[model samples]
Target: MSNPNSNFPLTLKQCRVIREIMKKGTEKEASSSLNLSQSSVSRALSQAEQALQVDIFTRGWSGAEPTSAGEVVISSCNSILQAISDTERQLQSNVTTLLKLKTYVEWRHLLIIEAVVKVGSASVAAQTLGMTQPAVSKTLKEIENMVQQPLFSRARRGLIPQTAAKQLASLFLRISPVAQSLQQSLQSLPNELTGRLSVGMLSFSCQDIVPIAFASIFKQHSGIRLQAMQGPYHMLANALRQGEIDCFLGLMRKGPIHPELIELPLLPAQYALIARADHPIHNDAKTLNDLVNERWIVARHGTPIRDYFESLFHSIDNKPPIQALEMLTFASSEELVIHSDAIALLFYDDWNINKLTPRLKQIPIPLPKPECTIGITLHRERQSTIIQTFIEELKLTIIDKLKTQ
Candidate 1:
């Protein structure tokens, strides 16, 4: 393998530096973590910016933030460097030497550095590298010794990769395509295009959208084995971030708009107050306020539907009544609302799709009509080709399902 740090040391180091700066989100923090004098860090960054012919950081008196161009470059580099590590591990295991290059120290360090970013700590990184913590530290020390400069900061907590790491991060991008192709060639190619995909949906969604016909469309790619996971929306979002599942299908709520996740709107839906035909409040209430003080059976707090109701109540000078019941499942929500005085805040489209009983009526309320948009989402950086294909199949299914309705 060609060393990414040889002729391109400056560029590589700059990329690493930018990653640190971006991660720290400030120059002082970046400089401190990089273990470099502020002036040295600034000079190296300046030279790298000139070399790459792009301004990688937006320098202000306060600190530096990654420029738009820098963000793109860093992202590309991160992916490439990860691919290189996977390639190296495969090659070393197989003892194949098609490419020879010096700077093996740098390559090895790059692997650890990437591991730290991926696993989020030295201990986790060590486990991933199949080495003990001390050995990982020693390897890191060797890299700093060879470079004749510290590339990471020692902390009471753990090692912090710096700007030098970011710069090297960028250099790996240039060489990754070759490494990826080799790795792909070396791995026993799967016959019939097989890949395992785990898909998650809200309980209501599973009951509604994910019927036999929906499963059949996804099964069109026999090589793609699809496993369905059902859970509450928040649980599924947590799973998506933790890599338990590849994608999430549900209403988008305002939470941390994780940079790692990308959401695609599938269809628009609206919210309504649903209650049983036999319920006292259904016949008694004419407006939102009349039902405000009444008992409510809602999806647990933090869901999009719950948030909508909360916002609706707040807008009309009322607080949501103490939740007499919390139903994370659509069946529970539908059953409780239809059988008792409990008012249900639910998505109109989902209610229709699930075909709730005729006893349940959607009570109109004069709040800003909040649309519960159903959408598809997946981790932005971790999506596999199979996941993308399944998502497309899912989208087609939804489109057809909605059209038929």
Candidate 2:
């Protein structure tokens, strides 16, 4: 089997040795307790440290002690072991087979299992993992034999994961990003940060704040690589949950979010009603009621902005303009407003106002100031140094730009 670079750098044996040494306070005691030679225990620690690119332990005459980085890694090891034990007990499996799990289960095994469960076909999983279909089937068979349970049920369309397979795949998905983040954090230098930062951006942020933050990050940390994915909010949220993106930038969602993700509110943004600079309605529009008959450009239903737009007219005991164009992007909305008599709603910020002043102008109609907070969302357990630094830069950029406005 080909072993790729895994998010978790250490093997089960290495983690076991390190955990024993941490508990026993010496390699000799750990070796005796685990029925292994001192050199073997030492070798495991050496290999783990090399893979992580950090010194995990400092050896001395008294005993071997875990370094700062080692403590973090050791904690993760303990968590993994505890999770495995919990799974064994929950499944009520044979003690002997479960005990051998640590020896047989590798990161690659978990990767294959996760791929198979996600794609629901051995052949597709094999293609995704750059392996043959037969190799994938063989690995699955080996895993099933080891666990003494069928992980998947054969179906005409595709394979269906059993409860055990789903549980394992979910566990891998949650921990893979966290482990990778930990490794990157340990390997990064204090003065220079290095890693890939994948970000998901909504339409609102793509125009101004996110790009500025990216520029700031690039100037400060040239070693860091940046990727930005733009899509609808629901699609982006799903991507963030699957560990496909580091963080999401846009307007904060209302109500409670997923337990595994955290929302950090940054600044409040107000909305503006905009029209072409030379529109005849510009001078006559003193209230929203005055423009009720005019053509309007608004977001589609189910979007946060769309809800807000409908609520605005309802507050005045009036229905919103029936003659409307449903638009999603500010660029398209601005273009439609410039050529036609369609008034559009947009963010009323200095950056946006300055950009739109040349062709489009904000109407003077009075509207309620609702709290639309702009912020970032991130996985609770996967914060890395690169992600934290980028957030800091983003906060600074928002504050600086707003202050100037």
- Candidate whose lDDT is highest: 2
Q: Please name the candidate that would achieve the greatest TM-score relative to the true structure.
A: 2
Question: In angstroms, how far off is 37's CA in candidate 2?
Answer: 38
Compose the digit string of candidate 1's lDDT tens values, residues 295-331: 8777776677777778877888887777558876788
Cα lDDT tens digits for candidate 2, 1-405: 355445467776787898999888898999998899999998988899888887776542234556556767888788776665565465445434543444456666678889999999999999898888988888888767656677899999899999778766776676566556667766554557655677887775545777788898888887565778677777777777776677887777774257888889877777788889999787998887887788889876766777888888898899977777887677788898999988887664555566565788888887896557777888889899989888888888878886775
Give the TM-score comparing model 1 with the true structure, all chains together. 0.50
Least accurate stretch of 10 residues (summed lDDT) in model 2?
Answer: 94-103
The true-versus-predicted C-alpha distance at residue 54 of model 1, in Å, is 41
Q: Looking at candidate 2, what is the lDDT of residue 349?
A: 55
In model 2, the clashing pairs are none
